[model samples]
Target: MTKKSRRTHSPAFKAKVALAAVKGDKTLAELAQLFDVHPNQITLWKNQLLEGAAGVFG
Candidate 1:
């Protein structure tokens, strides 16, 4: 059996998905399916966005 190819997503895409997660309009599972990524990844990006949001104020 062949291994599935790994995919790389752009920062803009990650930010968009993470922003959607922050919006609270969809569940992690839903976002995962919609973005074709793992739920944990979505959570990670969301946390990153939150952690870095303070930079915008500086």
Candidate 2:
């Protein structure tokens, strides 16, 4: 069997996923399936967005 290559996402895509996560309109599993990404990845991006949000205005 062949190994699958890792995928890379753009900042915009990350932001979109993160925003969806922050909205709390859906569960992580639902978001993951909808966005075709892992739930943990969505959590990571959400944390990153929250951590950096303050910097945008500072």
Candidate 3:
């Protein structure tokens, strides 16, 4: 069997997923399925967004 290549997501896409995660309208699993990304990745993006938000205003 052949190995699958790693996928890279654009910043826009990551921001979209991160925003959805922050909205808390759906579970991580639901968001993962809807966005076709791993739950951990969503969490990472969410944290990154929160962390960087402070810098945006500063």
Candidate 4:
């Protein structure tokens, strides 16, 4: 069997995912399924977004 290559997500794409997570309209699992990514990945992006949020005004 051939091994599938891992895909690298772009910054813009990550930001989009992070934004969606922050919106809180959908569950992490739903976002993960919609984006074809793992739920942990979305959670990580959300954490990054929250961490960076404080920098906007500082």
Candidate 5:
């Protein structure tokens, strides 16, 4: 069986995913399905967003 290659999402796409996580309207699974990515990726982006939020005011 051929292995499926991992796809690279663009920065804009990642930003969109991060924005959706910030909005918190949908669950991680929903975001993952909608964006065609893994839930862990969404969680990672969400965490990154939260971590970087503190720098915006500095």
Candidate 6:
């Protein structure tokens, strides 16, 4: 059996996923499956995106 390797996601990819999460177009589980990442990771990125969005205006 082969071991699963750790994957490193780029900022753009994370942003895309986070944006999708923000859009509410798909459920967290769906996003996780689509992005090949954990639901929690997507949520974290989504929250980070939201938290930092204010910086753009500030």
For candidate 3, the lDDT comes to 0.98
Question: Which residue pairs collide in model 3, if any?
Answer: none
Candidate number of the best lDDT: 2
Give candidate 6's whole-model lDDT.
Answer: 0.96
How many clashing residue pairs are found in candidate 1?
Answer: 0
Worst 10 residues of 1 by lDDT: 2-11
> Which rank order by TM-score, best down to worst?
2, 3, 4, 1, 6, 5
The clash numbers for all candidates, in the given order, read 0, 0, 0, 0, 0, 0
Q: Model 3 off-target regions past 4 Å?
A: none
Candidate 3, after superposition: displacement of residue 40 in Å?
Answer: 0.6
- The segments of candidate 2 whose C-alpha lies over 4 angstroms from its true place after superposition are none
Q: Higher lDDT: candidate 2 or 3?
A: 2
Give the TM-score of each candidate: 0.91, 0.97, 0.96, 0.93, 0.83, 0.89
lDDT tens digits, residue span 32-51, model 3: 99999999999999999999
How many clashing residue pairs, candidate 6? 0
How many Å off is the CA of 37 in candidate 6? 0.6
Tens digits of per-residue lDDT for model 2, 1-58: 9999999999999999999999999999999999999999999999999999999999
Cα-based RMSD of the predictions, in order?
0.9, 0.5, 0.5, 0.8, 1.2, 1.4
Write one digit per residue (lDDT tens) for candidate 1, span 1-58: 9999989999999999999999999999999999899999999999999999999999
- Alpha-carbon runs more than 4 Å astray in model 4: none
Tell me the tens digit of each residue's lDDT in model 6 across 1-58: 9999999999999999999999998999999999898999999999999999999999
For model 3, what is the error of residue 22's alpha carbon versus the real structure, in angstroms, after optimal superposition?
0.4
